[model samples]
Target: MAYFDQMGCKKRKRGERVFKFKTFGEQGHPVEFKGSFRQNVKSLLAFGNLGNSLCGGLASWSFQLEVHRNPPEHILLFVVEEPIEVSLNRHCKHCLHVGWGNHMICNKKYHFLVSSKETVATCFGYYEGNCNESYSGTAGKFNLVEFQGHVMHGVFHSNGFGHLLCINGVEMGSDLAGYQIMEFWDRLCTGLQARKVSLTDNSRKRSMDLRLLYGVAYSEPWFGRWGYKFGRGSFGVTQQMYRKAIQAIQNIPLCLLAQQFGNSSHDIPSMFSRYQTLSGHFLITLRDLLRFMLELKACLPSENGSIDTYHSGVLVDTTCRWSPKRVEMATRVIVEALKKAEFRWVSRQEVRDAARAYIGDTGLLDFVLKSLGNHVVGNYLVHRCLNPVTKVLEYCLEDISNGFFPSQEGSVTNDSELRTRYKITRAQLLKDMFCLYSHFLQEQKSMMNTGIFATTSLASRVILNSKYLIKEYCGKLPSLIQVGLGENSDVYCTIRVSHDGEVDEGRRKVIVPHECFMLRNNTTFNELMLEAEKSFKEIYFGLRNFSIKSIANLNAEGTDLVFKVVKVGGELVFEGSAGENGLNDEDVLEGFRRDSVVDCPCGAKYDDGERMVSCDVCEVWQHTWCVGIPDAAEIPSIYVCGRCEKDILEFPSLP
Candidate 1:
C-alpha cells in the first residue's frame, strides 16, 4: 500500500490549522469566497452545526470575531492571541481547574481536562522548568496559551450526567497528528463486541497545502479522506439524493437501486458489523500468489470443495451438519489453535467459494456473513475498493474501549452517567469508523494507481470480508445455506486466464494449457491466476505433485479487491478422492459478455513477454504464438502482421 507516499508530516507552523479546505461547496458549484478570512467569518458559521461541529468549533471559539477590529489573518490566529478560557458547558464555571498535576522528567505526560472549546483543549498542555521548548508567539509565550502537543477534552463529571467522556473535542499539532490521534482513540475506546468495535471521528483539520510549492499526485478535502461522508456537506442536497448516497454507501457501490429495495438502512455501523478479514490488504503480483501456493503445496480452491491440506494433514469436510462443529475446530487449528498469527485479512469469498465447491452448499458462507452484518458488495465497481472499513479495523486492532467506557484511567467522568454520555454505542461509533473508512477509500482513489476502474464516483461503500469472525459469531451452523448473486443481479464477468510464465524459467517443460474461466464476482488479476492454477490441476495438466504453471488476466481494464485471500485447508485430498462429503467436480467454466478487442489483431491479450512479437509496421504488439509463430520462435526485428502487410501492399505511400 502506498499509504505513506502522499502523507506529509512537516511540522506545523505555530498557529496553522490542521488542514485547509478547498471550497465549501460540492462537486460543481464550489463555495469559494473572495473576501478576507475576517470578512467571511459569519459565512463560515452558517455551514456547520454551531458550538461543536466541523468549522463551527473554530467559529465558536472565534464567534463575533467580525466584531473585533482587524481580526488578524485567520481564525486560529485570533483564537491564539486573545484566548477565551471558558468551557463549552457554561454551568461548569471552572472547567480549567488544576484537577491534578503529576510531574515527570521531560514533560508532564499524564494529566489534563476536556474543553468544548477546541482551541482551549489545544491549549491544555504546560511544560514546567524541565520541559523542552514550545512554540513561540505573544499568546503562545503565555504558558497558559500555547500548548503544542495533543489536547483531547472529555466532559464527564459528578453532576447532571456530566463528564460522560463524550469526547467533546481534540486538537493536535501537525508534527504529532495521525498516529498520535490513533493512540488517543485507542486509550479512550473500551473494547470489542462480537468481533466488532465502535468508534466515531470527525476531522476538524483543513491543512493549507500550497500547490505551487509542492506536487501531490492528487488531493481532496479533509472530509474526502477521513470524514469522507455522504450527507450534509453537499450543496442543495435533497432527501432523495441523500438517500441515494446512503444506499450506494452501503453496497460498497454507487448504484441507483430504489430505496425500497436497497440496503438503505445500512450505514457505517453496518459496514463495521460486516468487517471480517484481518490480513494485509496489500496487492501482490499473481506470480507472487502462485509462488506462495507452490511453497505451501496447496491445491486449487473450489466453491463446492472440502478443505484438505495433504502436506499439513488437515482434512475439513462440510457434510452432516458441517460434521458436528468440526469446522469450528478446524478454523481454530488453521488460524489460532496452534499459533495466533498476526492480525491479517481473511477473505470471506475464498472460504465460501471453496465451501460451495466442496459441499455444493452456500449455507456455510451465508451463516458466516450473517454474523458479520450481511454486507454485500453489489457491483464489480465497489469490489475494486480496498474495503476502507476493514482498514479502520486493522489500524485500530488493539482493544481501545471496554464495552461502553474508555480504557484510559482518567477518561471516565462519572461511572453513573457513563451509559448515557460516555457510552460508545454501536450506532454512533460505527458511524465514525465508517466515515473514516470512506475517507480512506477516497484517498486511495486519488492516489497514483487508481483509474476509472477505481475512483469512480459510484464508489462509497467498502464492504468488508470477515471470515475470521465466522466461527466466533456464526454459532450453531445452519443446515442448508443457499447463497447466490443477490436479487436480480444478471451481471457476469468472463476472465481470460492467459498463462503468466515469468515465474517459469527454462526449468519447466510445458506451455500452460490454454483455458478461460468465468469470474463469480469482483476479482483481481492475481485471483485470475489462482483460478488458472486450479484449472491446471482440475484438468490434470501434469502428474500429481509435479509443478504446473497457470496464471492469467481478467481481460477487463482492472479492479482489485484488496483482501488477503487466506487459503482454506491446502491439498490433502489425493489423485481422485474429493474428500468426505465432497463433490467429484470436473473442470468447467461458465463465460459471459463478449471479449473486448485489445492487443494483437489475432484477438489474444498480452501473453508471456518472450512469446509476444511486436509488429514493426502497425507498431501494434501481438502474441507470436497466435500469429503463426512457433512457441519456440524468437521475435523478428522487422516482423509485420498480415493486416499491416495487406495495408502496405494496397498503399505504398501509407506511413
Candidate 2:
C-alpha cells in the first residue's frame, strides 16, 4: 500500500491525502519528516537522489508525514513561536495591569486561547477591567508555565484619556492612571488657596516656593515618552495649574487681600478698612499736593523706576502698572509747588556741567560768561547768600540773620525795625558777599591752558579782575593817613605823598603845623579838612586860600582828596583811595595820594611862589640872588658851581 501510494494508486477512498518522505545520509546525518504534501515535496527536493541513496549503504532515516487538511498557499508565520510578548502600544490597543498575590501562592505563567489565538494572562486576585467575558477562556485551554512574578513587557493605557499616562519604553502598570496626575495638580492649588499667601509677595520664601512648583511641573522625565495628551505635557499642566491658582487669588475679598499683604500686625486691618470705607471720598487737590511738597514729604519723580512711599501713603501705588510719563507729570506738579514756597535746591549734576563750561580749554573768563547764559546756571545766586556749611553755632547765626530780614523790595517802612532785624546793614552784606564771591571765583578759575570742562559765571570773572587790580594798587599807596587813636581824644599825625623818585633828606616829613589831628568819634571828612586847614595856617602865617590837593604837583595833574579810612583798635587811619565811587567802608583803599613835593639840596622846599635856580652840575636848587646872580636872566643852564669848578681846576684852590 505504501508503494502503491507512492505510485499514486488509489485502492480505497481516503478522507484525507497523506505524504511520506525519508532521507539517508552518512554519520551524523540529518533526518526530516514532512507533515503535509507540500512539505513532502519540499523535503524530496531538499534531499537529492532519493531513488537509490536510501539503500546504498548510506545513513538512512525514515519518518512519517501526515496532514488532516490542506495548507493555504501563503500561510502567515511568526518569526518567533508561542507569541509571549504583550505590547501596550497605542496602535495595538493593549494595556497592562499588575496584581500582586500572597507569597504562599506559587508563581505561574498562564497562556490563554482567545478566538483561537494565544496570549499571556496572569492572575493574582485582581484584574483591571470588570468585563470578564472579554477575557474569558475554557479551563482546558489554559497552560501554566514557570512564573517569575510581575516580569513582563506591557505599559499602561489611560483608556478614554488616551495615552497620557503611557510612557514609551517604560513598562508601567495601568493602575497608575492619568486621574492621579490631575488630582496632584488640584491638591497643590487647594493648598495655595488655604494658605492665602499673596502671589504678588516678593518675599524670599514665597519666590522659592513658586519656583519649586514651576520647576517640578516643567522638568521632563528622563525615561518617559513626551506625549501631548492629558497630563503628559509637563509644561502645559503647570500652566493650567497656575491659571487656576490665579483665579482662586482673584476670588479673595479686598479686605482679606490687604490683611494678607500688610506686613504689620497692629491695627493694619482697621486702618486699611478705614481707607477702604473712604476710598470713594479720597480727594487729591492741588492744595493738598502743594502742602505735601512744601513739607518735603515727597520727592520729584525719578527716571529709574522706584516706588514712592509718599504716594503710597496717599493711596497711590507707584508700581510698574502706572505709565512713566504720567508719573513724571505728577512729579513736576510737586516741583511747581515747591517753587511756590520759594524752596530751591541746587542739583550738583547741572552745576558741575555749568562749571565745566565756564572753565574751558582756552579762556576761563570767556567760558564763565557763556555759562551765565545757561538757564539753570543764571539764577544760582540767591540774594548773594548761600549756606556753605552747617554747624551748631551756624544755626544760631542763621536764626539771628533771619531776624534781620531786609525788606524784599523798595524803601523800608520802619528804620528801627530794619536796624533791629538786620544788625548788619545792606551795604555791609553787599560788600561781604562781593568779597566772598570774588575769593571763590579766583580759587575756582583755572589758570592752566588745559581745556578740562568746568563751570563758572560772568559775575565771578569781574570780581576776580577787580580783586587783582585793587591788590596791586594797594601795595604802592602812600602811607599818609594814620590808623587807630590813642587814649587821648587828639593824636599827632604826619601826612605824606607817595614818592615816585628819590626823596630829599629835608622833605622826608612834610612839617604840618597842626600836630594835633582831632579824633572825633564820628568819621566825617569836613571835620577832618577843617582840622587840616587850621594846622596849615598855624605853619604859614598870613597865607590865604591854601588848597590841599590829593594828587597834585607843580607839573603833575591834580585831584581832590577822597580819603579811605580804616579803624584799628579804636583809631581811624587813612589807607588809600581810588575815587569817590570806589569808596567802600569795608574796602581797603588803593592808589591815593596827596600832592607831590619838590625839594632841592639847598635846604629849602621849592614852591611856585619862590624864585629858584638849578645848578647843572649837581641838579640842586638855589635862591637866584643868594647864589650871586644879580638878575634872573643872568642864571645859566650850563653854569659851573664854585666847588665843582675848583675840583675841575677852573679856579684857584682854596687854602
Candidate 3:
C-alpha cells in the first residue's frame, strides 16, 4: 500500500487499512489475528449441500492483500470464517493422474477453477473438432475439480471464439482477460497453496478453421490481396487466360506452334534439335531463341517500355541482375514460359497467326497481347535480358496497370481449338449425365411411394433400361431388325416357365431366339411360330397351333408369365402384367385398337341431350329422359339396369 501510494497512485478516497492473517505455530496450532471491530458480524452461508471428500488430502491455500476505499468512508474489517476445502468426489479422484492430471474420455484433460468467494465452479474441458492435439507422447496437465457430481454437466463455450469454460453448465469469465481470470481464481482459493497458473495458448481457444493459412511461404501483401479477391468476381476473360496458360504446359501444344511458325526460321528442324552441344549441353539455336522472342513481342501487350516508368515497383531478382518494374515482372513471366516450352520453336509469322486466332475466340486483346508488336525492340531486349529466381511467381501485382500476358501463344499452340472442342464434348456429356441422374432420382422417388426402399444399385436400373446409356448395343438393334440379313439378327426371349410343385421348387427359364420383329405388331401366336422357324430350327419347325394370353396372378401355382412384345403406335412395348421385369406398376401396357364410330343406344350419332347420362354397365351414352331420369343429379353413382345390365351381370360369370 505504501509503495503504490508513494509511486504516483492517485488517492480515490481516504480509508484505514485492516489485515487478518492466519498462521501455524510450532505445535501446528492455528493462530488467528485479533482485529478491532465495532461493526455487526454477518454470518456467511455455504455454497451447496454436496458432501465433501472424506479422503481429502491437503490441496491448496492462498493469502491476498485486498484494498478498499470510499468517499466519507468508515473502515470495516470482515473475514470469512469457514474456508472452502479442496474436496474431490470419487469420480474426480479416479480421473486424476500424476503427470498429466485429471482427464475426461479419450485421454482429454479437464481444468477446473472453483471459487468459494463467488460460490461458482468453472471447469474447462476439451471439445471435439477443436484444437488439434499435440502428439508428444505426453498428456496435458489439468486440475481435478467437482461441482455436483461429474464436471461434464454445465459445459458451455463461446460460439465466436470457442472459449470453453463451464460454470455450472454455463459460461463465466469468458469475456475476462487472462490477468483478471487469474485474480478471480486467487480470490476463490485464498486459503489454498499458491501455485503459478499458466495460461493456455490463445490458438487453442479459437473456433475458426485457420489451419489452411498457417504457413508464411508466400509473400504477405501479395497473398493477402489475392486471397481477398480469390473467388469474388464473375467468370470472365481472366479465367480463360489463366486456363490457357495452364493448358499450354499440361497439353504440350507446342508442336502445332512449330508447324505454324516453321516457315519463319532457316533450318526449322535444327531449331527443335535436342542434341547436346560441344559444351556437354544441347545448343539452343540463337535464331530459334530470336524467333521465340519475336513471337512473345508480337503477341504480348506490356504497357510499359522500361522500369523507369514505374512509380511504385518491386525489386525482381533475375539470374543476371536485379530490376524493378511491372514491365520487367511481365518479361520474367514470359521467360518462365519459354523455359517451360522445352526448346519448341515458333516463327514470328506463326505468333501473328496465333494472335489472330486468340482475338477471334475471346473477342478481346489482353495487356500482354496488346503490348506485343507495339514495341518489338523493347520486348526483344527485355526477353533477352530477363531471367528470374524460382520463387518469382510468389510476387503479386500491386496494381493491374503493371502489364498484360502474351496469352496469344495459347491460340498458336492449338490450346484455344482444343479448349473449344473439349467444351462441346463436355457439354454433351454433362447433358447426358444430368438425364441419367434425373432418371435415377425419379425412380427412387417412385419406389419410395410404394413403400419400397430403393438402393443405389436398384436406382441404377433406370439408366440400364434407357436406350441412351446402352446406345452402343441398342442402336444396332433397329438396323438388325430392319435388314434381317445377318446370322445373329434375332430377338432373344428369356421365358421363366413355372410349374405346380413344392415350395422349394424353382422356376425354370429358357432362352428362345426368334426371328427379328416376328412377335411384334399384328402378329398372332400361330404366325409367330411360323416366323420363329427361320431362327430356331428344332422348336419352331412345322409348329402350327398355339395359344397366347395376358398373364395374371390368381393364387395359381403353375401360371406362366407371358409377355406379348408389340410395336403399338411406334413404341416397343410388352402388352402384359404391370409387374413384369423392367416395368413399373403404373406401366400397364394395352394393345392398339380401332374405335368404331357407332350410334349410341339412344339412336343418335352424337349425344346432344342436356340431361345426358351414360350407362355404367355397357358404356352406352343415353339421354336421361330416355332412362326416365330427367335430372342429371338423379343419375345414380352406381349407374346400372340399362338395356345391357343382364348381359353385364352374366359376362363375369361366363365359363
TM-score list, all predictions: 0.19, 0.13, 0.16
| Per-residue alpha-carbon lDDT of candidate 2 for residues 287-400, written as tens digits (9 for 90 to 100) | 221122222212323323222121211122455443544433332222232233344443323333343432332332222222222111101111112346731110000111
Best by lDDT: 1
lDDT of 1 by residue, 22-87 (tens): 111211112223221221222333432232121212222322111122322111212211112232
- TM accuracy, model 1: 0.19
User: Which candidate ranks first by TM-score, i.e. highest?
Assistant: 1
Runs off by more than 4 Å, candidate 2: 1-571, 574-610, 650-655
TM-score of 3: 0.16
The CA lDDT at 461 in model 1 is 21
Task: For candidate 2, report its TM-score.
Answer: 0.13
Whole-structure CA lDDT of model 1: 0.27
1 versus 3: better lDDT goes to: 1
Off by over 4 Å in 3: 1-84, 87-207, 211-321, 326-330, 333-655
What lDDT tens digits, residue by residue, belong to model 3 across residues 1-655?
2222332123213342322211211111121111101000110111111211211221222122233243121111112121112222211111111111111111012132323222222211221122254422112232224333221111101000011132221223232333333333332222111111111111211221111111111111111221211111011113233233222222323243344335654333322321110011111332222223223233333433211111111222364232334443443343334334443433333333444542332212233323332122111211211125432111111111112212223211224443332222223323422332242222346534332224322322322211100001111122213322333122332122222211112211111211133233334544433333322222221111212222222221222211233222122211121122322111111110123122344344332213455666556555565567755457878676455777766676656
